[model samples]
Target: MNGPEEGRIRLTVLGGYLGSGKTTWLRHQLHEGQFARARVIVNEAAETPVDHALLGQASGLCVLAGGCVCCVAKAELISVLRKLCDERTRADAAGQRLDHIVLETSGLADPGPIVAAIKSDPVLVYHIVVSEIIVAADARHAMSQLRSEPLGRRQIEIADRIIVTKVDEAEPAELTKLLSTLVSINPAARISGAVKGVETALPSFEGVAPDALPDLNGQALKPPVAPTRLQLDDSIDWTAFTIWLSALLHARGDDIVRVKGVVRTPAGRLLLQTVRKVVQTPEILPEQDGLGEDNMIVLIGRGFTQSQLARSLRYFAGKR
Candidate 1:
């Protein structure tokens, strides 16, 4: 599974609970040309792999059948990804470089372990970088599923972006409640509605800095923590900000769900995001009209306190 790789491949993992329309959202993306230059891996517990069949004649489509790719078939998943990387490298000479790789997990899968595997794997980490974890939630049944299934809630908790599917069928009140619940569970995730199809632009890693990716193999790690969110109100010092975040992830990488926000730094305004333990390169954004200079960051993770975050951030602010 080795080849003459040209550059890193962006990987997007799509996950959700059973009957949450993960397949439907993927179908839309394929038809809409959103994944035009991407290789897709579909995981299904059943032997037949119905979703693969529905996505007929699409190039670079593969399926991992008989088990969830996150657990029972994790090794197989890695093999498939490596194979794609090799193929991409071979095709590079022909000017057919792979732009991205999208993995659609079974509705029952937990994306956390799948993500951890990618970040932990030495070989895969070199060629692949996770762009985002997009979770599809059924708007009509989301509340019920959230209450009954731990996986359902966990999916929302770790998502970078959440697409609420089947919105056209859900009542206004039901949709409102579902949106409220989702916000409470993961304040850092960007939530969007998908009715007939997703019209909104799906999140991507488009201008991320190259140095944002952490060195997973070299970092000293710790136990996973409980989920918590921290919102900061003041500007941050560029040097102190990097030092604090690097140290935090170095020690508690496993506990972090995601850290995302826009902050005013000495360099400029930048958009920041981290999935699992790996951070995407921060993208510099243009200043918006009528918004005064302000720095705000929302940290969502497991097992940290608001006071603890506030105190640490205050120390950094004082340095600024």
Candidate 2:
């Protein structure tokens, strides 16, 4: 977008294992305008999603979010970038410019495929460039999760910058142990701690060796794992889906992890959020004129699918 300064598009790729607070950090970053004027791509693994609703004003900022950007949504990722570039060109024709691009990958996702897609994709090179990978870790649970999850290790492996969140929840001893563990996982990345909400500081990607570890062994880091993606383009019956979803939540709220998305309602475009059974109707933004997409919901869990819950949302498109 902004052509005069560098003719380069700085990209910040955010990644962290599930529940590591990636969304919270992104919400802050986007609001701060740190990555201003950038096209954002948010990826989620589940059919019932979480962060989208909490993203506040930035919900309209996202270009794609269904599954991991590197896996199932790779094509859409490229399409969004191309669209961003085209928009920038139009702006240039009209005497304006844009800034960089930011990508927020699912917590459970491995940054490998997404990185490869951006670096190797021919068209992307014409417009954007990968700036850095920012990995967030929950200080309270990071050590154990790093040891137990392959996705966790992969996130650390690809990090150019590592940030520790939820420091207030961790004791001094636990924080010390976490820093020690992080050194072994990624010594090159600068480590910083965050508490509650306000940890706003200039991002640092310095001291990260380009070839920090050749042949990064994610497999040796943890047990076997599998990745997934789903795409649906069918129309959704909002009335039926909403009624069914509410009933299902009342019955098995404990089974839900996180549910979030922009839903089409008779009133207007409504933002929905569900943390287990507790559902809150978030503030609705002005109608996005001419934007046409399904009443989409992305839910993520240990064993969730379009078949079981998709029917509940069957009035909507069948799990896209």
Candidate 3:
């Protein structure tokens, strides 16, 4: 009644480089019957979470925001997973059932941590499984982005299935060249092609059957690796953080593909998530307990200095 009573959940991960159209493909899958009772995690390492806003309206989808479901937000992700599991158990008590979990990583996110998260969280390990890693690539930019951007390339290399987006816009020769290049980089992935408004290439989550995940026997879970935590004070000056972020973005615009975070501003706490060269306006979320304890932000890109980023935000600590 509440969650899935007795059914198979196809857990899928959709990943791609910036502007590679991962969101477009995910939107298509969410609406199709091929998917049922889906949970999504949109990871953006910036002030605003654009994807969260994009997916918020999906009727059957439940989303967890304010952190990527990877290293940075691993704790939060665990918390979310535990809560969902508890919900399932409660539903089971009431003779109800829930469906599946689908995670969509930000373009700049590393799928490794996400994989690691699913494997490591004991409570989640019992309820979820790593069904597939679907990586998306821009047909026009795959070669250069894969060769030059480690983050982008890692997304492609780790995929069980790869989807090449923007094929319709590319010249026929260009699409062929892109596919060839991607193969050279990651020969293990199963590659498919798609363009705008195309759903032919993306896989349906429904295909992930209950018996599919043999690895999740709910026996043992590995201990989690330690994670670094960043917390900001209630008096943080988000204006300063914004100014500093702008300057940092200007300096590393090429490397900084996205920035998203929840910060305390003079007016109130707001959520920010962005794409490269596109900073979304802050959105106010319902006030909750401990919202300010871990004032989190993510800086996703190459050549980024975490210390420098932390240093810049230290100004928001109200001590400078």
| Winning candidate number (TM-score) | 2
Report residue 296 deviation for candidate 1 (angstroms): 53
- Across residues 1-320, which tens digit of lDDT does each residue of candidate 3 receive? 23542243446777777667786677776656445466665655443344554454354444444445566677776776677677777888677655667777756567888878877866666677677898888766666665555666678778898888867666656566667666666778888877652645533223222211122235364232111223555665667766766777677666666565566676676766554555656677556533223366655665646675677677644455
Answer with 1 or 3, whichever has the higher TM-score.
3
Report the lDDT tens digits of candidate 1 across residue range 1-320. 13543468989999987657777688787888888778888887544344554454346788887678888889999998888879888988999888798999976589999989988988888888888999998876677657644667889999999999877767766677677777777889998878645754323323322222223445454443222345545544667778778777777764554465566676776766564455657767665523212354545445787688778766766733
Q: In candidate 3, which residue ranges exceed 4 Å CA deviation?
A: 1-9, 60-67, 200-320
Query: Please, what are the lDDT tens digits per residue for candidate 2 over residues 11-43?
Result: 788888765777778778777776656666677
Question: Cα lDDT for residue 230, model 2?
Answer: 30
TM of each candidate vs. truth: 0.60, 0.66, 0.61
The alpha-carbon root-mean-square deviation between model 2 and the true structure, to one decimal in Å, is 8.1
Instruction: State each model's CA lDDT, in order.
Output: 0.71, 0.64, 0.62
Clashing pairs in 1: 209-281, 225-302, 226-302, 226-303, 227-302
Top candidate (lDDT) = 1
What stretches of model 2 exceed 4 Å from their correct place?
1-5, 200-299, 303-320
How many backbone collisions does model 2 have? 15
Clashes of each: 5, 15, 20
Which whole-number lDDT from 0 to 100 does residue 277 have in model 2?
58
